[model samples]
Target chain A: MAHALEPQAKTLAETGPGASFGVIQGLDPRMRIVVASVFSIVTVSLSTIPGLIAALAVSIGVLLMSRLPIRRTLKRMAMMDSFIIFMLVLLPFTTPGDAMFNLFGFPASWQGLWKATEIALTANAVILSLMVLVGTMEPVTLGHALHKLRCPEALVHLLMFTIRYIEVLREEYMRLRAAMKVRGFRPGTNWHTYRSFGYLVGMMLVRAIERSERILAAMKCRGFSGRLLLLQEFNLTLRDYVFAATLCIVCIGLLCLDFA
Target chain B: MHIVDGALSNPVVIGGAIAAAGGIAMGLKSLDLDRIPTAGVLSASFFVASLIHVPIGPSSVHLILNGLAGLLLGWAAFPALFVGLLLQAVFFGFGGLTVLGINTVNIALPAVLTWIIFGRLIAKGTPVQGAVWGGIGGAFSIAATTAFVAVSLALSGDEFLPAAKLVLFAHVPVMAVEAVLTGFAILLARQVKPELFYKGASA
Candidate 1:
């Protein structure tokens, strides 16, 4: 599990300092999150190619301005784009419309191609916007921003704890995995393997429960209450307002293009 | 089985958000203070569970384990699975932020349903019986989730119908694997720590 989480942990660590150096990183995390979410919603709502193209342009502009590692961002986008490409291939074959071409003796529809492109553009635009906006911010900052945004308190706390303990649990899992490997146990597609894996998961859960008990005890010893006290203060600067306004105007313009 | 952002129409997205909010509220209301740590730890466990990939026929599939979660956490599965989905979106980009609500609904609703339908059986049964019922709950939850995901996509447009079908067909193997895994998990839990199921039931 630690091995599996290495890439994610690395990405998170890489983004932490890079976020502070980004062009839009100066804005309040709340503002950045709100603007990015709004932009993504509008991007998803787009139906016309022109509208999507404009949304993509806005996203790219933010990406360039943020100075995120371009190669890493593109690699993530490509991973997401593979799903869209799958949709592209399937939609053309399954959708009903006037024939645009023949693929393996099946009539591919223009409407299918159109819808596929629409989905592709919408997904890409949203992914790019997130890479620039949410990806740059620290998870704790994002959690605080969500709390400020009126997200449910329980959900917010859950997110924080999940992030905090994920590494710990991954380490525990790696130990278990190592133990299994040392015993020459390799995962295979068989009932014996499934049962062994189940025991592994069960053991992990048992440990997790016991660990949580210890955590709760520690928290209570410290007079910990249900409410988390966030120390980070956020003040919206003039540049934040300007950036948000610009993003809103661009989003609205793209929406108007969708109707046009 | 996570749905990416921009995959659904506005109406579907709005509806999913509303429904998810209701589930999360119920989950939070039922969650007591002592249960909080358990929920958090279980949530983290669920998050890490996704990293466990098991070999299938020609391909490997990762664990979703919403069934086992529901069996152990009941209504809390909503928030637990939601946190997992949130982190997955944040770190791996497996899903999107905007569609988090819908994705939450698509996955967690089945979890809650399984809890409602099978939670009691697991609580009352012997080890072997618990495994049997747990297996049913596991496979049933996956099937229900695939159905929910398919309906969400199909509701978006006629053009998405094929994708919807594909999502369902793709999960068939996952359903079987989850059943076996959940069965063994339940068996082990019943033998090792029966208290977890009892606590889940009382919650």
Candidate 2:
């Protein structure tokens, strides 16, 4: 399905290319990576309502610690909610359980309501924590952290190159759109509009491929040997260890609360 | 389009993860060091595709364009698209962490399949001829992707069946728009850089 990364088109402008702040900024990038993954898995396995709420609370705590703008991060989480809202709204009607209410002769169920609430809580918790702990980190640091974490080298390289080029290509795209606007190209529900947009995409791809060729040549001239070197240095300090332990403890607490 | 975390049965989630891992392995195998820049740049290019919303009456829909990605990148579309999804989830909170595997499989599997089925035909013959095949391939990929997504939802539980069907039907218009756009895109590429389609490693 066609979905925008940000419904409001402000995620890029707001993050401004990743400004690390407060405690999350000071922690080792690798630590943040591990904590985010562990927390997500732990949150996913949680089922009880109270436990899920606490997970959301823990995520909020992380957001505060990261010093990311709270309203912006939660708004992004709400943006994701818009996509799943349809399925969630329909769940109560389709699911069989104790009756809650009726809409258009369709009886909604309490069990289905609980299920939707469960999903909503779990998704928000994971995404919120993820955005705070990992999303706010400079993308280049994330790549290097993955590299240090022993992810596949080529995959890491791809991630780095993609991060490096998104801004460049997006600028290229903006320029194209601006030129179209200057030419009185107003996109609408017409054959001509789709055709123009398609050509625009095609032009971007063609230019992208050609540009990469030039980059490869330039890199080769400087002894580029298929591998882009990552010169990031990482060392885990006591604070990173303490921060990771606290997160792990919180995760264990969540699992215990869910099961017990 | 994203399946946020905790929405699927454990088995479906695990199975999707395994499938995605296998696909990514194949994609990486096909992607040598020499092709990294090409693959990376093209992947970033497609990322911009989602930001371009085409107006459809009162509502505008962004472009997924995975079919065109399959045509250009072949098997390499797997990791390339995965990278895009990853960026979206981490940067924009667009999807979930645990569901990344399933989401990747849903989106990229169809892309690779389209490449397998239509990659060569879209490269050969006249520009117009290639574009016709490109259009077909574009529509086909969207169809296959929605089917996969619906199947994943249905498999997760009985409660999701209606939602599954709805997801499938809602994407019909997407298939048409994507088909036309992809056709025109291929037409442009065929006219400008005919050699772009020759890099189909899986072909």
Candidate 3:
């Protein structure tokens, strides 16, 4: 499912307004990692309405500056919002605070709603920041950044393989799923067929592993090295410096906005 | 659910990070080259489990065999999960870097429990029965771990209840899907990969 959408996501991310502002399109993966980590921390630490609002404003500003088409970004944001709405709906009924109203046997409180809104918004912020970070950065570059951070070597190796194989797996999954669909394995809305659903997963897993083994064997036959050698130049040029400086300035500016 | 970095209470993230480090260290200490096939198969199986979804209510959820992983790999599931989630984070962005530790613990806890349960039941001589328990054990373990994660997030006092509940409730349907899928997965192993379940069987 995810594999099929990769090309679409990659294009939308690159061509969208977020990409246009050069926020995600130009930054080094290393710097994007730093920025994303910092933003997430700051967003989580924020509690008050003013603080959240300020953070939201900065994120929106960055999105706008990315120069990707606003409509494309909005469409993506809308897709994300639908998922957020599920959480939003639960807040009014389950959360307790200063009562705002009694609707359909549920007590809706102003405080609860406000807090709920914050949760949803912050969740959006987290996803949005991540979108920018990933959209702009290359996968291998990010992998290197992880390596540079002294992340476990085994983990790095495993992660690199998983990412590399995800596309392969996705393609394999699609073929199997399509085959199942053709075999009339329609998953209905009923619950009884869920058991069969489990069977389907088991079969797919077996097939995937079988396929991976073959792939692994084939690679070995070719004397495949474990590492994926990146061909991109990693020189820290003047442009890279400027990019880092701008991010720092933005971070400082956001902190000041939160404080002030 | 992948817990992103900066989402958890600093203490939870930091503590999880330490525990994960210790777990991986332990895994490496016991690591044998012969388990390569087991690790490879289980990892691939784990990856595929997430692809097929079981429809429930208004949403759909899929099988994720952190429990089965634990049953098969025991302590080794830690490194496997850590690696698996890190890959998921990078390739699909299903999770993030900072949340890697939390997600690893969430998935590994079940895998370890399943391993323990598998050990006990498989010793009883009925491989089928062992597989059944292993399946249920895997499902319940995942649910328990998920709930624990939810509670931990709520306790972080970041006004996380709504977000937490969203996650918890979403899994209600997913938990059932995982339960059924786990059972079926174990059944397949019992038939075709019986050597994987039996201690002395030749691979």
Candidate 4:
């Protein structure tokens, strides 16, 4: 898991238009957020096998055309597969159903098994589709999306600031951890060590707050407006309308197939 | 704990979105500029803290600073959390886009509740007790919320017993670690930058 996150972190550090598809990459950041958010909602609402299959198909089609590497995208999906699978495995035992097999002198119901399998598949499919959606979108795009959604200006500003300071706080945490390692501070199940960790986190917060204050102050000193400058413009182009309509049509078609 | 998109039902996911938006609206109503940096820093802390995963018996769990969030930000933790979770969902795919709202509520609700309860508890001027209870509150609040999340997921017509037990049991050690970390963080604030805890100490 740690290994998986490292590449993602690196990928994030190396973000640029050259690294992503022209459409997804070029779309206003806010628009991408809106599209991704809407797509995710549409994807998760799908439960039936056919419905999920259609959503998964649309997601995969998007991914293939998005210009991102399939290997990297699959790795992202595979990284999270374990946790979703772990959650899914429990479905068969818990969902009500007819007997399938005896486990430790208990009958495992067939109905339970089928229900579990369906739910598991649905969960995995939805998760995978959503992963593809997010994996293709950028953070700035998401912020822009929230802004467009009429999210409060204060909230939008805070999110932007939070993104700006992620690296700074991350650096502080690394330095602190290294210091702890140098001090031979191996945290055990002891009160003293626990207290030390808490102190580090609290102190980190204080330092972060101090740094943010200076940063915000410096920005304000430069005639900072309440809004950060967003340069990208996304209009309702023919392509965007086509994309939305096709998505709805595909989703509806899948629902019909499932019921049929 | 990041929830990936499509992992939850649409209704639950949509409900979470509405709730997160509502929480942010209420939080915005009470915003002060002085608190902006604190909120931003807390969001950063929340993001970074999630990256640190302590090993425990074949499964490793990371720190979630929702408790710390409550201790510092109180009511405003909600919007900070909503945005943070959304960011995590987008960049890391740690949680899914569909379930962003639910995941945010799961983590932020405890922090908000802790703030409500701990706000009064800490105001009594007992640093040590405050830190201790704050630690306890942080620990139990998250655990309680996780349990609720599991049970809710189970009851969502998608099987219940095994999954619920697995999730709840898996979090036991994680909660302990959180308590310890939250406790120590507060204690440190008391000692070095004591003003973070008490207003007129040295600010």
Candidate 5:
């Protein structure tokens, strides 16, 4: 029953559209990831409307420079916006403050509106920064960057393997779902439905474990060590440094404005 | 229940991150070399499990299955869930990187707790008994996660109290659904591959 609800993973493009040709894409993947994360921290820390607006502008500017696929980004933003919209609707009535308006005789406060705006703007700002910076780099590159940044080696390896096998497992799950559908399995709130879905997930895990054994054997045959060694090396160039500096300065300026 | 970025106050976020870091370090230390592949495979299972949505009364909610992960993996559930959350943030943007620590702690802590509370019961019981306990652990973990998420939000500001209450109320249905689902899953695993549960016990 749960298998019926599984959505396919998004098919990643060779290089994400619009991001392929962007100036940000030209920077080191490590630099982009670090800077984007720093920017996101700043955005999340923001409380003031003016500070949030400034951060949103910076995010938009980066998005325009990155030239990421606008339609896709907007679609994702719309999905996230649903939560923001819910918060906005609820906050006004629930938050106690100087009443700014009334909806159906319910008091809506200025403070509520401001808080919602802050949350919505900050969410957008951080998301846009991620779309431009982290979204542009390949997953493997990002994994390598994380490894280089001295993240736990086990974690790095686990991330890489998970990425490699997610699609395989999803495909396996789809096949099982198709088979169940052929047998006229319909999802409902019942014991049979729950048991069947449980079997499906249990079967998937069984297959995954077996496949991992084969994978480990194959890696050993190829002289694989416990640590992952990448052939590609990243060097920070002058342009990369400049990009980092500019992003940091912009973020720091936003923080200062919030204080001001 | 993922807490989105910017929703949490600095102290809550920072505190969650530190506590989560400690959990992950402990998880890493407990993760043996032989179990690395199993950890990765289970992590992927968790990653893909979120795509499975269960339709309840008026709406549908995706499966978290953190309970199943914990029942099988024990403390190792930490890194597995962290990786899944990381990928979800990067690819789907369901949660953001800045709030990863809080989100991880909220979701995974209950999983670890489930193991602590139910691990022995599940290991020692008959298949039916295991299934019953699994259901309790499943429902209990979701309830715990909702509380953590609510606390994280309410701690941020009084303005979020309503949202906090709503978050808990909304998940009530999900809790029941996951309870049934997890119960059945444990029954199946016990019949076919009881070793999975015992492995966690020994660990």
Candidate 6:
């Protein structure tokens, strides 16, 4: 049943080099994107605990199918959980419902506990499936897919540009930090530290702007216009159709269980 | 500061999505194709910048330099920051897919607001004056963001009221840190590259 989730990848024959994909990577990118969104909406609408658990199960099932590193992906999900744990903890005390227990003289209601659980399960399920489905794809292909899905052309170009330059700028950032470290910079609770960090960011922005200027010049010299030609053409294979069918059936089943 | 998928009510989610879509369209309209490269690179730099952890007493908070982004990108900050948030959700799972719209609105709206309110003053001032305005803009962005986040939560249900309040309180130090860093960053940019803040109103 975990085979309910699938993905799309661009191999050497399909696209180009640096393809890191797995079993379900043969599915269509647009299909994966649509399926993930549908799954999230369904998961969020789920009210019953069992229904939500089923939604999470389906997400894990997708994770298994996508062949992503299981432990690492789940750990990331847990990290997100850590972010909201405080709010979840506050829920049991805040919601006015039947008293379940006492925490520091405050009544923790069962309804509140259930609400917290519902949120955790829903959040985890939606995010888990999202990571496995779309996150597994190459960022460039994701941009192309969004473009094909009728996203604004300029927005897609921005996404592609950001993806291409993130690594470059990250290297520049590391080099800057290295320089700062060599200067015996130790961040602490002080104004100097803040100012230095501020200067660091300011420096990065200045360099980035200069780099972009050079890039624009290079593009112009190469006879480049403003348009970015999205060269990737996605075709829905048999596997993609099967994946879509399975997702539809599974989502319907979850909704049934939720309303039943 | 990303609210997860199931945490928000449908009305809040839908409203945020619509609002973000409108903001993004406006932002994109202001950005012609030629400026795409500039905006894209700046957006990436901000993405990397957010990874920086500035120490605050016993602990540290990661930077959210939306104010700085606004001071540079103006209306374009919406789409630029949305790209960052989208990458975070997909690649890192920091935020959820459904909540992307709302998260973008919460973070980027304050950025544009900062640009509008403080853009001109920072540009016309001396380096030190520009830095001070930059600092206030930075704090204002975070404060507005926290307020937006709080309102998004409180609108969902009465149960989220306390959490929303706590969210605001927890961000106090973050605002202070962002302000100082943003001020210094603006100060440096003004001295070194004076055009940075000057372009804020129309970028």
Candidate 6 reference-contact recovery: 0.81
Clashing pairs in 1: none
Ranking of candidates on DockQ, top first: 2, 1, 6, 5, 4, 3
The candidate that achieves the highest DockQ relative to the unseen native structure: 2
lDDT of 3 by residue, B1-203 (tens): 66544446777866777878888776654544334434545564567566556677666665576776666667777887777775455334455555577767777866676666555564345656755675577667777778867876787664567678668776766666666666766677556656555642212
Between candidates 1 and 3, name the one with more favorable DockQ: 1
Task: Give the C-alpha miss distance for residue A195 in model 3, angstroms.
Answer: 4.6
Candidate 3 per-residue lDDT, tens place, A1-260, comes to: 13333346553212332334464566666666777777766676666666677666666776776665566555555554664465567666666677788988778878768766676556556556665565445455566777666665555555555545555556666776688788787777765476666555556556655665676677678776654455564555676678667766766766666677
Deviation from native of the Cα of residue A57 in model 2, angstroms: 0.6
lDDT of 2 by residue, B1-203 (tens): 78999889899999999999999999899888778898999999999887889898899888999999988888889999999999998988889989999999999998988888889898889999999999999999999999988998899899999999999999999999999999999999999998888866343
Better of 3 and 6 by lDDT: 6
TM-score of each: 0.95, 0.96, 0.80, 0.88, 0.94, 0.95
Docking quality class, candidate 2: medium
lDDT of 4 by residue, B33-122 (tens): 656766777787777877776655555677787877866776678888887776655554455666667777887778878777665565
lDDT of 3 at A255: 67
User: Which pairs, if any, clash in model 6?
Assistant: none
Candidate 5 residue lDDT tens string, A118-189: 778887788778866876677777789999888998888888877777777877887998999999998876
Show model 2 residue runs off by greater than 4 Å: A1-20, B201-203
Q: Give the TM-score of candidate 1.
A: 0.95
**In model 5, how large is the Cα lDDT of residue B164?**
87
Model 2 chain A: weakest 10-residue lDDT segment is A1-10
TM-score for candidate 3, residues paired by index: 0.80
Candidate 1 DockQ category? medium
DockQ of each: 0.65, 0.68, 0.35, 0.53, 0.56, 0.63
Provide chain B TM-scores across all predictions: 0.97, 0.97, 0.86, 0.88, 0.97, 0.98
Relative to the unseen true structure, what is the C-alpha lDDT of residue B187 in candidate 4, on a scale of 0 to 100?
64
**Per-residue lDDT value at B177 in model 1:** 92
